[model samples]
Target: MAIHLVGLALLMGVIISIYLPMITQTAKILGSGPMANIPFFAIALVSSIVIAIASGSRTEQFQKVATLPLWLLTAGVMSAGMIIGSSFLIPRIGIGAFFVLLVSGQVLAGMVFGYFGLFGVPASALTVGKVLGALLVIAGVYLVTFK
Candidate 1:
């Protein structure tokens, strides 16, 4: 379990390193506005299709065809909206700030959802340490962008 945790941490670190740079470049291409979402949509479309084929699944059978929840659909739509919105925002804010705000938003949302046991996550509250850590991340974002 410890090894698995370490491996996952390392993998996430690598992903962050790669993703941040890509976001910066994408922002540059899209002029730091919401238009960046076009590439996001294209990537999502290709990935979804690839994943479906690789996993031997389709939208109809993706997750219980008839019982698809509205909440999930809403979340999916919201994510797409962010992708589009980010395209426009990235150039102005820069990728570092963009990711900081984006990740912080995710962390806040995740904690809220986890606390309420929403989306199958176990109920939990944000600890003081987590709050501090988030603050530090925000501070880091400020330093990275403004300084």
Candidate 2:
């Protein structure tokens, strides 16, 4: 299970690396704002539907979605906001700078969320090692984002 999770994480890294460039190009080509979501999400929706059908998962499971807290539903909104913001920023900042800044924010947020166990995250106390690692990452972010 751990091996599969590691593999999945590695795959996600590749996808995110490609995703930044692809979305940046798409935004440049479209010459439109958030409307770029139209084609991107259209493809995503179709791909997701096909995958869902192929996976043989039970559609009935989605019925439980309504039982979840309303705040949980906002995750979709957050995803859209992230994509849109990334599209707008990547071209101006350069992908390397943008990715580092994004990573920096995620690291900080991940630490806080894990520490407090907010939004379903498992509680984990902040340790000196984690703080040092985060500080190193933040310093890296500053170096990459600035001159």
Best by lDDT: 2
Task: Evaluate model 2: give its lDDT.
Answer: 0.84
Count of residue pairs whose backbone atoms collide, per candidate = 8, 0
Per-residue accuracy of model 2 over 1-147 as CA lDDT, tens digit each:
699999999899789889867776787789864777778878988998788778888477557767988888888788777778888998889889988988788899999999999978899999999999999998999888896
In candidate 1, what are the lDDT values of residues 15-134, reduced to their tens digit?
865754565577677675345556766887899879877986565675574587677778767765665565556667776677777777777778789778887889987799878877
Clashing pairs in 2: none
Worst 10-residue lDDT window for candidate 1 reads 32-41
On TM-score, the candidate that comes out on top is 2
Q: RMSD for each model, in Å, please?
A: 3.9, 1.8
